[model samples]
Target: MAVPTVPRLGPQIGTRLMRRFSSCPRAYSYADTLPNLKIGAHTRVLFQGFTGRQATANVKESLEWGTKIVGGVKPGVEGEHLGLPIFPSVKVAQEKAKPDASAIYVPGNQTADAIEEAIEAEIPLVVAVAEHVPIHDILRIHSMLQTQSKTRLVGANCPGIISAIGKCRIGFQPLPCFAPGHVGIVAKSGTLSYETVASTTRAGLGQSLCISMGGDVLAGTNFVDALKVFEHDDDTQGIIIVGEIGGAAEMDAAEWIKDYRRRTTDPKPIMALIGGLEAPTGRVMGHAGAWTAPGEPDAQTKYRALEQAGVVMVNHPEKFGHGMRTLLARSLSKSGTSNTLFGNGLQKRGYHATRRTTLASIVGYQQKRSLYLKEAQALEILKLKSVPVAEGDIGSNGLICISIDRSALSPCIVASSDPESDPRLLRRIPFSYGQATVENHPMMADLADQLKIPSSSRDQLGSIVQALWEIFKEKEAFVLECQIGVSADGTFAAHGARFGFDDAAYRSSGRQEEIHRLRNTSEEVPEEVEAEKYGIVYVKLQGQGSIGTLVNGAGLAMNTVDALTFHGGHCANFLDTGGKATSETVKASFQIICSDPRVKAIFVNIFGGLTRCDMIAEGIILAFRDLHMQVPVVVRLRGTNEELGQQMIAESGLPLHAFDSFEDAAKKVISLAGPQ
Candidate 1:
């Protein structure tokens, strides 16, 4: 998630390579001489299964494009061929040619082996051009790459990576379509990648690095991984991400980009184009991994997600080049800079420099002044200042004390009066907890402005509180414990007082005790401990004895809740099993719902995507048999083996009711629950 900053631009290479190249004048001079060197310029590649006809043609084309294909690997062809040395294996090739990178043109069945050989040989980068590799084998190859941590894999069914600036081709991508420039392209489809590169080059906005991340069910490298690489490549100032429908990789990339922008002062601009806009559901479009399931992200969903994350969504693949050009042009124009490709455009856009504070400064300030005010003194000062005091008695410790009516309070405080309502008082109070310094003064203030004072005038109390806030604003003299909250019966309750914002003090005080009491007595569940513990999310509703609802996916869960609520039925809790639900997880979810004494009926609604519906039905049967629950259970299953799941539920011979329609299930569950 943490992206390393691109090396600073200087006479030498960017900061990333400065440590190694700074010591070598020849390297620096070579870089200085070229200036447009791509990210993989130093990469020396060895081909796996090099003696094959396909490998020979691709390697020859790559060599003709000025790529550094140092050597090749074949089981028996271990000598020199086509002016390049061939070895028995990657390890042997490595010792002889000392290749730092590798490309695989081996058959689908042998693709995993080739990749494994490259990884074992410690080749830093491996690109697999073979297609139709088994999912399990790809998984193993991905696991190996992860365990090694040093090697980066590009594809199983991909066009591979091309560095136009470096004149290097590691995959099967046609070299004639690319040109060296500042823009970088990361794509999921092979033909789409070519189209992107061709269009960008046509627009005279050539690319620095163009990577086709492969069209496998689980790509070894995802959009986020490629984005990180582009983020740190000095040669790439603008980027275009080409995504397809199926997985959450695009969404993940969008989230990562947002985080990256927040961490770095200046971030390179990024645009995206998601494919499969008109493609039908359940149909695999060319790529084996391009088929999307129900409730999973589609093209429009990805577009919205990326757009919300600040990535410009190009409507068409043809517009990719124009979109990037316009975006970069606007950025440069906003900064009042020329069309230079490799400068810090982010800094010019008013990105603040990183803030650094020493630990000594914090410790020294805390040590300078350490003062505590007794409760009596604190109350007396507030009383003298004409501050509105709630009807409460001063405790032995001088803290105000009042009895809390638990029945009058809600399960949770949804909204409270603004702590900083008075503009004069706001000037003295720290805006955030981080800004709270030891030097600030602690002052008594009304927690609720609605609290009435029979003895004091409102205007007089406000003036006094403002004056006190100003006096204590310069020093850490505020006692946060003097705060109050409104009871359910419309009475102001004063609790324990503590100096400053001390978490431990607040927790130990009567305020915390009241919260604990409410949680214990209230029908509402405090947190989703059980669901969260089992790696799922659950949200409890307000009323007790309501129908409990369980479903897969957030969208499905929300739809179920809305449908139940719309039909005059109350939901006891909302549980999302997510995409990878198991029988164990479903049993846990059922147990959680049944634990709520208020839940009279359990409504299980699942639309499986990656999760199988049969697994959910099995869990329901297990829960019913094990828990021996009295509550009526209503189940509705859809998508991915739903018919088998329905049959299993029917054969269970349990009192559980199964339905095909969500509406029927909701109404049936509500009717079974009866009056709540």
Candidate 2:
């Protein structure tokens, strides 16, 4: 012992802590001044369901990464396997080989039990990789952790956490995609996180930690939880949040970041990349929890929210690394930290650039000049075509100026066309403008009539709409107003008509014949056609349901429908109030939902962000007062003056059940309506 004294790791740990403190004192609160407890080289891991295929493979890979996987747990498999001891239970294993953390690999059905076992063993950290676990089970598991506050859970359906600096792995994240550095990655998506990490590495930025917060609707951890950890972690200098559609987690994080920045002097620079910009509304894309609800935050909403919160938002996923690199460079420069590491990392990654372009130039380009048909020309063409035109003047530009009837067009598709030019007549119709109306318009009524005729007649509304749309593409003549019905009733109406540029020219070009042929040809209505027919923001066709939903966002609408369906209920229709939920809009939305004979009960879920809850509640109260709402209504209001909204609803003395949670409101509605 006197001849050979053991070398202490204390100085090494102290040096790391000191470096972290030197960078930012706020990084480590006084209570958390000691080194953060994370899965690292020195931490021993216990594998739950070790004999399982997923565990076996992951353990082998972890061991290859030099992770200290001490033992495993698998009932009735108490024998040595993979050179690691297998125990009957976590308690028995803890007595022999103490594990600081646990990696759960049991089937989803048994995942909750395994997690409970780990918590009972008092393991500080538990990473659950099992997907498709029953949501109820996860809720219970989370509840269990709440009681035992010391235990931390990573995921229920996530890929898990990785510490690049520690060279330790706790989940199934690909190791090659990671590098040890200062940026911390927190995401609800596993594959997206991998892509982000790879991009960061490519950009010469390494990560301190990468956490996949799981894709389940109810994950054990969220963006804020992970962000708080990264905020205090000494190793992490910056943070990147990769979020997608569905849930208010990202929005919540943005709000937290706003407060965090306001409260702290040395706030870390944060960047966000929100996926699903192109994702269609109401559809579940990829992750189980990645569906957007009506009025719920979409990609654009999330982007704006994060940006407003002072976070750098990357529009495209591929540019995450570039965004982070640029952000970190700026942050470091502002903090007077040397950016030599960034340059060296980029150089090592084989990146060479003589000059750096602005992010706006790199990510987005200016719009190309559009072909214009002056408003005066468009009005003259409408008059020539025997189309009814509202009294209105024109702007200096070619854009149409008319009194739009918002009421008739509850939801309308507005398009423009040049009625003069004959080149590829049908292809020229620009049906770009589409939206739900807040008031009734005459053009909307006409449009609704046209759509209704085709929808009820041959069900060839698409062909008719297409045929009519070609009128807009003519020449210098534009169709000022084109409206199509999005009401429950199928109808199409148009305020303006087209006489195919010069009739002789249109006839000679053979486009008129093609248009006629398309209109006459009866084709089965596509799903999109149906969607367009009714201004339904989102709809899931179960083919049966007496309950309908009037929700704020598409994500919330979908969740409401899901909750109803899960509780043995059915949805008659889906109506989203969209982003601008004014009293009139909300009233109109409720009327649409209640109009459906099948809808015996209505579930109104509004999670206000830009749309104030008080406004929504006022709308509901006014709608019921005016319409004498016959259906049972369950309303759940949260966010932005929610209490005031609730009080307003209560004072209105309407026959409405108001609750704080969507789950409770949904359950109440379903119970009142009975099983569909």
Candidate 3:
């Protein structure tokens, strides 16, 4: 039984926008300016939590990368960090700095505060990169975001947005994966965004803009929102989407694609990849929004939906870049233009590469001659040193490979004897975000005498470390390694070093020609990059599943499915509104559940510790009024505010039946589901 994860499905979310902005609907509409979703190299960005360690590092990177950072906001600190002025509040910073957008680098707990401040200041675009933000907070703030006109938020748990062609990066999207071209990208998974760029860039089709719609159950901006911006942007000739298993967003995007094809004389080409196909069901994977919920579209269903809309499909992650290049070549050959409809010949991209015993034989109409065609494909492996990926620093460091881990949301340097460590000597050195310096780098020895290193070698190593740091910052490398060799005289020199830096960096880094001279494009497949942060997990049941379970929390959603199935009941879908579901989310859940034909009845079981039953009650009333559902709904409320919720439900006189006992509620839903 496919359980639940919360993502604002496109259609359902559209309904929300209409109502929220009904007061002055035109203000929120997508205009030529794309006031919120669209950004460029010229966009002025503000850093919230400016004095913060993470914010400092990000601001430093952004400034170095050519992002037009006006200033930042951090309460109780009005001085400057990195030569940018700081203010106590967003409003003050807005008045002084006059930023076009706001980039939030605060914790999940403080995310709402940061976003609300940006919204109140009327920041044109707000980008939040914090992860694991409370869903209820999102629901609340998302509502607030709608009522206003001036602000459009990118993420609460997202990688943020980047304009690759423009050289403006708000969030920490890898620069090496991007190249300036005509393809615009919007994706849920961050790593998949890299994959999309990796594919398109290798094809010599680079990105105009790429927006990372963070993998939370909810995001301020979604796939459709990004699409409209792409449609409007003159620079973009094509688009690529990286979607996961969760939500109806992709289906909604397909509808938009179809509409775009119908309305425009020449539509931009689109390529898409949906991951999490082999993912297991009913739990939190890497991301909060990566899982399929009840009544939501599955990965396979989404893939076909996109293809039906004239989108070129990427069959696998590894094939994303190469497959796209292949498909576009085929499309261009037939159409003679970029209005590429990958029709008829549209199959998964490995026919030539696949092992086949037979060759195609072409016979003439007269049967006079037969022309047999075989294949001649390249058989070569990728060479090392051609790729810029770093090897361990080889000299006094003793072949130690170093990497940065951010699992704790802080920079922790991982040092190991083996690059791919098993049973090996491993050391983790975690430091404050902005604390690592050439002098204080964990690997860099503080006192030469303390480590018993010869003063000459230590000084040489320090110089190497300083040089590496300078190059790292200037080149914007995600990973870089240098191998140094020392002789008997203690004179050390760099020998056969490995380098992995941003592809975009060299372009603007003034050393483009020099870097190019070092190596051509590395054979690094960006698809191999790790998958980005996402939401809950669910395995969509293909057969006859009936009962739609609306529950709070991922852990309990699975349990509900198990119990229902054990009781001879099948679940049509699972929707987890999180622990703190508001009335808006509850109504959305009802809308989603009712839209599913298989769900004859709904069993809403709420524990309500963080969730208020009163809100659910209110949502039930709203759903009945708005949705006008045919199916019966069984309500089982427990925990906080249960009595008031029951009273409200009882007084409403709606068809919703509230049961005190789980047995009664289960029996009622099961009976209703079993019948016609």
Lowest-lDDT window of 10 residues in candidate 2?
Answer: 362-371
State the lDDT of candidate 3 residue by residue for 406-495, as single tens digits: 222222333333322221233444332223354444355532332245655766655554555444444443333433455444455444
Best lDDT among the predictions, by candidate number? 3
Stretches of candidate 2 above 4 Å error? 1-37, 293-295, 335-676
Instruction: List CA RMSD, all candidates.
Output: 20.2, 28.5, 27.4
Q: Tell me how far the alpha carbon of residue 337 in candidate 3 is from the true structure, in angstroms, after superposition.
A: 9.3
lDDT (Cα, 0-100) at 358 in candidate 2:
28
lDDT of 3: 0.58
What global local distance difference test value does model 1 have? 0.58
Runs of candidate 1 with Cα error greater than 4 angstroms are 1-39, 293-295, 335-676
Instruction: Return the TM-score for candidate 1, rounded to 2 decimals.
Output: 0.45
How high a TM-score does candidate 2 get? 0.47
lDDT of 3 at 542: 39
Per-candidate TM-score against the hidden true structure:
0.45, 0.47, 0.48
lDDT of 2 by residue, 144-233 (tens): 443334467778778788899898889987676678888898987665565567668878888998887787656666787778888888
Task: Tell me the deviation in Å of residue 605 in model 1.
Answer: 43
lDDT for each residue of candidate 1 in 189-290, tens digit (9 for 90 to 100): 665566567668868999998877777665766777677778879889898888876666887888998798789765677876666543333333435455
- Judged by TM-score, which candidate is best? 3
